[model samples]
Target chain A: MASQEIETLAQALARLPGFGPRSARRAVLHLMKRREAAMLPLLRALEAVNERLSTCDMCGNVDTSNPCTVCADPRRDVRALCVVEEVSDLWALDRSRLFPGKFHVLGGRLSALEGVRPEDLSIDKLLRRVEAGGIDEVVLAMNATLEGQTTAHYIAERLERFPVRLTQLAHGLPVGGELDYLDEGTLAQALRARRPVS
Target chain B: MASQEIETLAQALARLPGFGPRSARRAVLHLMKRREAAMLPLLRALEAVNERLSTCDMCGNVDTSNPCTVCADPRRDVRALCVVEEVSDLWALDRSRLFPGKFHVLGGRLSALEGVRPEDLSIDKLLRRVEAGGIDEVVLAMNATLEGQTTAHYIAERLERFPVRLTQLAHGLPVGGELDYLDEGTLAQALRARRPVS
Candidate 1:
């Protein structure tokens, strides 16, 4: 009976991104024994987030407000937009503090195999935002993968009639990454996209 | 400024049991971008657990009550006691669904090098509970480590005068563990502690 309860809890925990059945079982047992310390808190947090959270209408990022903090901020540059596959990509770019522009989350990459088409993503909304004018550049900061590249090319082509300048993040050896450690595909891409020294 | 926030969040996340700084940064960014979906839930859980949580006075385990559910339950075998070091350990044993007895949490092992003395742990409470009588057996289910063994020995010596039987979990090769993969210490100990087949 106790194991049944544990199994149910484990299933619930397995719904988390990185948690599998084994990890879920470990976590559930860990939480149950430390009920006062972790379980109740986690439960409350889940409930609270479920009740209070919303999606940012502009960026499609999850937030407590309709327009997220970044979208609502008047000081942020609206004309320079960074495009990404997911909110996680946007967060990664935000953490870099290199770009001082707004973001457009595509929700997911264009995956023909996965049946994700252009309309399935936020591409229509992105086109509308860009065609509204005043936007100078669109930085395609999607992952350096086939689906990411395909999505980027598709978006770029869609905006070909517009006056917006399009660009992508440089493809090269990552910072502190060794060439020997890099995968063959990445190495090839890095070599192919190499730029001449100034 | 954004990097600093990410760093701070990463540090906070790194304090979780299994995560390191790199994983913490990844988790923090994931949370931030999925603020509504993940971060808000985590924050609420933390707050709820912090606010509503309390430790069981009897066993030093975390619970919503003073004595805790285990201690309060009349169905549990009070005369058979299982001893463990941390609250997490107790929870682990509980999930096994074998023991039907009450528990005594020692809180920590006896580490002479670390200056963790018998008095530093809940050894006094353990002695008191044992001395109060009615206990048929006291199972020392502490981890199979030097400090844990030392702590178990101390408890055994203290209860030598009492009529209660002392027992311990069998130590040997773990289930599904290969003999070739066994560490030298574990192999040696297993050989030394070998028992005849019933």
Candidate 2:
């Protein structure tokens, strides 16, 4: 018979994004088998993250510090700000190490179907950051989805009055993308944005 | 920038049986977003399970109690014991509520490729439980895999001198399984084990 505590643990794991009931059951069994080698270390790591978890006051990024690592890093380009829809997006971009700038996580994109509006997000906080000045450019690095574009457009309109230069991520065929496999919209965008041979 | 604590949490999650690096990152971000609603409860549950986790001295099953819920249940049939390769198999069988008997977890199947011997499993403990007397029958409900069958055969031979009756699960088409989709071995086994229409 499954104990109440083990069932409770499985239920909690099932609530996570990717895990379903079967996978949660398997994971719990796996953890129970390797208590010292796996479960204890994971428990300790989770406790540490939970205890120190904090949000960046200026940029809405979740981290263990008030200003977050990116915001507090003096070596990062203060003049360039990358605005993203969520902390996951921030992480994905930061992982590439291509952008040497601070990030502002908007929490989520504006979704009309989901009843999300400007006030629901950290848009005002983003505006306030720009208003405080010294940022030379604001890159709207939102996703290419309908809601993402809508949110980016809304933010661009709001930042129109500011002195900072506004830009968005360019749309094009992805690296190693086969022309036959690419969608029509992507093909059109790639053709329109085609540059002279380098 | 990803904090050390967050990275550590992701790495821990990645080490789980089904999780990869990408899914681990997504899970961490999801947990961070709903820290109070999700992460804290999971942490508490893990801690609770970890604090009380114990191996059943009787059946080699894992539970918060030494005897395990199944072993301690007086309503269960003491004369019949279902033998399985792992705790997961025990849980799966018990979940069906079809087995009124107790269980004997073998810990793992004997495998020549992996160098697993009979001594590596809880076969001795199981034999001792039967030798102590009371069991009228032993059901070898091992998996259909080669190693599982090999282990079952070995155990059956060892228990040949005992007073108890020996039995095994039937090989047949799974409930709702299509005949055309079945493997040749499974079809052959099903044909070989065909019973009366009644």
Candidate 3:
């Protein structure tokens, strides 16, 4: 039936983050109705990107090349490494343009409920990369979640025996955010990590 | 060059109703990250639908055939016609399951500011269809906006000489809506179009 095709399309669309069945239906209908104006170009772009894309062999970033543009670039600091949970997180960091170091994607955090262990992540590969030497520092830019904290702790502890300096992104009040508006946890972290103004 | 691609994609996406550059970038990044899971299927679906789609010669609705399924179907009531501003509006009416008549998509509402004239729309085609005879009624189901009202008035004036009965969707408080919560304009419309409750 015609409904079946719509249903299949809806299901596929629903798999996208923040899209439920109703939104999926609306999106699918919009795409189908505007096939010429919007859908065709979108389709071509998707096809072109998919045909060319691959995972970065060095740092696990999604790219069209083996090591990814970031890892392959000679100017980027391979001596400094930033670690993150997902490619999205890595992309977010890249968008900030604050750090000019190489990256290691952990894929996911240590979550007992989800049965995600360190071995299941790229932790072993990270250790191998770290032990190979010449790396000056490792920045744990994991999420502020409990699992992320635990993973960072585990990684830091494991690297304590190694010669590389370990650092984590500073925890504090967000820029442009009022102190009174801060959550209890963030406020406490900000207080604990306070430094004298330069 | 890479930034230009992102910018172009963002601009294209932002042109879609309800999507801005932030959402467009999120969507593009999501597609790029989940190339196999989301992007490939979306691309294939878009391509498949685009390849098969054609505008209905009679009704301007996108379909796999020239006349469209609705226009081609002999079982549908040809004596009753429903007029709407857009194909989406027609689809909404169809979903209601109350209307068994054929549809006339006006493509857009009358907007003097936008320089959208009646002739620029399918008004001539609609008049031709109406003049062909056998139509008992023409239901105006344009939106409740200023342009929608203006377009409805233009259509009504144009078809006033015809022998067909003209009707519009009843205007009142929406289902599950409280009169106290309605805006001044809505309340005025509801009051003007008040009916005797059984």
The DockQ scores of all candidates, in the order shown, are 0.18, 0.80, 0.38
Runs in model 3 deviating more than 4 A are A1-11, A20-37, B1-15, B73-75
lDDT of 2 by residue, B24-135 (tens): 9999988999999999999999999999999999998999778899999989999999999999999999989999999999999999999999999998898898999999
Question: Which candidate's TM-score is highest?
Answer: 2
- List per-candidate RMSD values in Å: 4.5, 1.8, 2.8
Q: Model 3, range A1-198, lDDT digits (tens) per residue?
A: 123445566677676655676676666667777777777666665665667677787888876566777788788888899999988788788878888988999989999999999899999899999999989999999999899999999999988888999999999989998988889999999999989999
Evaluate all candidate structures by whole-model CA lDDT and list the values in order: 0.75, 0.93, 0.80
Of 2 and 3, which scores higher on DockQ?
2
**TM-score for each of the candidates:** 0.78, 0.94, 0.89
List of clashing residue pairs for candidate 3: none
Prediction 3 global C-alpha lDDT: 0.80
lDDT at residue A99 of model 2 (Cα atoms): 97
Interface RMSD of 2: 0.9
Stretches of candidate 1 off by over 4 Å are A1-14, A20-52, A64-66, A72-77, A175-184, A196-198, B1-13, B21-52, B72-75, B176-183
DockQ, Cα level, model 1: 0.18
Judged by DockQ cut-offs, is candidate 3 incorrect, acceptable, medium or high? acceptable
What C-alpha lDDT, on a 0 to 100 scale, does residue B44 get in candidate 1?
49
Writing each residue's lDDT as its tens digit, candidate 2 over A1-198 gives: 788899999999999888998899889999999999889989999999999899889888888778898889999999999999989899999999999989998989899899999999999999999999999999999999899999999999999999999999999989999999999989998899999999
lDDT of 3 by residue, B24-86 (tens): 767767877777788877666666666766767798776556687778778789999999998
